[model samples]
Target: MHNATSRELNVDVAIIGAGPAGLTAGYLLTKAGKSVAIIEKDETYVGGISRTVEHEGYRFDIGGHRFFSKSAAVVDLWNEILPDDFIQRPRMSRIYYEGKFYSYPLRAFEALSNLGILRSTACMASYLWYKAFPIKTVKSFEDWTTNQFGQKLYSIFFKTYTEKVWGMPCDEMSADWAAQRIKGLSLWSAVTDGLKRSLGLNKKPNDGMETKTLLETFRYPRQGPGMMWEAARDKIVATGKGQVIMGYGLEQLAADGEGGWRMSATNKDGDKVVVKAGHAISSAPMRELGARLHPLPETSWNGSNLKYRDFLTVALMVEGEDLFPDNWIYIHDSKVQVGRVQNFRSWSPEMIPDEKMACVGLEYFCFEGDGLWDMADADLVDLATTEMKTLGLLDPAKVKGGAVVRQEKAYPVYDEDYAANVAAMRGELEHKYQTLHLVGRNGMHRYNNQDHAMMTAMLTVENILAGERVYDIWCVNEDAEYHEAGDEGAEKALPAREQVSEDQAAALNSMRDVPERIVEADADETAADRRVA
Candidate 1:
């Protein structure tokens, strides 16, 4: 970390936000002998959405980060940074609906028994009906899901919990959201996966073969994800290659005439600090960053209009050695506003400071300044207690104490206008600011996982070092192939040698110098390969 007392400073790179993206860039750049400065608004936290919150003696992640990635580079990076601290954890989660807990991945017999013979029959019939008469035009999440899982199962499983998370009717939400999240998942696929998983066929750690939904195990930092970022921060500072300045909120930014950026920030005590850097990588929320620009571009309007979904977690300390066995459970019942519940002990036993007591986080999704967000912490804790008892997950009397954490702009809203707005903003930024690059979820206004965000940062660093846009960060999470592309995709149109066919390899070798990373990482996954394999 850098001393905030410095009134004026300069660096080779100025990064906004100390999240996964910013820290990854900082780590890689600093390791390559570049001077860097990371400016983070929050004085205490470093991982942004991936941070861990310590309340009293109990520690819990804001959003539990399962260190699983198809990208070999991302996986290798994780192993490089926090190898010793990583713990392999079994993945177990369930869906709580109507006072019953159904195993996630939808255990066949459990779901059947819980839904009863008649309702189960109805669900199968509905699935067949949808297969026979699928929706011609699937515009909304409801429509898309109904077509895939049938109306009965969609209503029984997806509808209520999804609505609680997005705070909108399923019909009002975009189908793109569903498509991006559950692209290959269908009723038959889920059933087959569930049965296979039950038989221990997909129990291995993610090795690129298992779909994300079927993964039975994952890695996690022993202390929490923050352990990784905190280590990265210390390593960068120790190497004297970078300085991470905390509590410095960016106030204004302008392009320096000398092919760089001049950034002004306000420190915790209201002191202003100025920095001049040759390049800047921003992971700040697009909306917030747009408001801080000097001589703002035309895309500022679109940036300002970008919407975000906020989240709050109420950590309840209960008097018990055992809670529910699952790492987390989706609260599918519409009766309660709590969207999900997480048992910290299930994530990692070390997460709880006390062996005799269990810590659980009741997660609620809501808009900033809305009823749930504005509710008092005490009331929110009470609500969690009541809901836990109502769901039969815990007893209200056993609740010892609680704490609350509210995260604003936790998720970028994927609405009707988001794509157009983001495109405009991205176009203007790329054209106007040669030295400025946007990376990460809030930075790009894209809903991506931690590894995906890290992949963007890794590519951004490569681009900076190569003195050009050598990689397209946008393609990181587009598909399995992109994730598998790794360093090979940093320079070529095709994947690593063994993953591509001879013709594809020849095509890549013959291609002219492309400005950005290959957009089609999956360009070689031909139908013939699937059939042959």
Candidate 2:
């Protein structure tokens, strides 16, 4: 592969990573007439975690994500990209807790009544009992939920699932995750609201704030979330001032004394090019960016400080199967070790091949080298089949071909000491260069959902357009206490000199093409010859 041109091209912005964040930034900036280029290392289409995998006409999203953010800007962006594609569909999800299926959002009365009136009354009594005497210490996410809802309810509805997600004991995990996820929800609120409606009580909050039901109906793309980003990519590229360069891996970054940085990249096509950017906003993980920049100081803190967890999903092309009703299921049984399972067709019928068939993405979350990641492919299928059957999900026999996708650095883990170390590195990078800005989950070291990620990208680009020295990537999500409303008016803060100089903005753009480093240095589970448990 040869260089398209020996021209030393320079632009106002260069976005790293093509996920929702990077794509959203590119879309907004390009539309604003800022010349932009999105650099992605993967050979596949960009969506990052929200990306869709297409095999034999069957589509599988890396994780089960639906459109449900309260952010107006995010919603507006969604509408702008796929206005017609927004399908207001009902969500049918249940929790298989303690071998019983409980309606998610924990329909208090129904769940209690089903457990028998005695237990139902006890549940209500205990719930009221706990609320009357709230726990003073809100330790972990589990503690916060239990204190609010009661221990029994917490154990049943939240404990297992939360443990599966963070891979930590409920008591050990942070309450912040719970607050961001489930703090405002309550049985009392749901009951009073439902009873008022059942018995003609007070009017409800707007359709969005109906707490009893988290999302009675939600939005989804006809294809997958990728459908929205792909469209944005096309529009951005069509602008003629911007281009999304796929498979262009970042190799190194060399900064000129004048504040501009040069990026050397080796793309998938094996072509090498230097991207001279006026400003660079990266949506990839920050640790990876740190490693990619050569001139490896004989010492670095990123070695084991940051860890990447890989995601494995097997898209089962069943023999005309209707495996599960929910769009997804959380797996918490220790015996199985699978994090969650998704019913892709539940999001849309288009995810499957034929009208009569079904597609299930069995998700197994594992670190780089746990024994499970070292298994054979056939064993993996067998394990998945057995586990699904054990959990009463999949019948051991009705399966067909299995398509596996293993992703590394999927989730950024917040361990005991990660927060301080990540901040230290980011602090150094902030004063070190003008061209680089880390935006997405990995980049900012924040556990942001897809909407948050997208908003980060949008904000970064907004900074470029406004010529403002805006909030850094880390502050977008982690800085504020996130209410369910999402990061709405996050940019009110301003200093006397908030605008970036023209040369400062241009200096910021040239960090593209430097080989983006892959951090945590985990082994590639997908490449292993062995596949299953």
Per candidate, the number of residue pairs that clash is 0, 28
What is the per-residue lDDT of model 2 for residues 446-494, given as tens digits with 9 covering 90 to 100?
A: 7667877775676676666666546454444432223223333333222
- Cα lDDT computed for each candidate against the true fold: 0.78, 0.67
Give the candidate number with the greatest lDDT.
1
Tell me the TM-score of each prediction against the true structure: 0.82, 0.76
How much lDDT does candidate 2 score? 0.67
Mark the regions of model 1 whose C-alpha exceeds 4 Å error after superposition: 1-6, 107-109, 121-138, 147-151, 175-213, 299-301, 478-533
Model 1 C-alpha lDDT versus the unseen true structure? 0.78
Give stretches of model 2 more than 4 Å off.
1-9, 108-156, 174-213, 268-270, 294-304, 470-475, 478-533
How much does each candidate deviate from the true structure in C-alpha RMSD? Answer: 9.0, 9.6
On a 0 to 100 scale, what is the lDDT of residue 504 in model 2?
Answer: 26
Clash number for candidate 2: 28
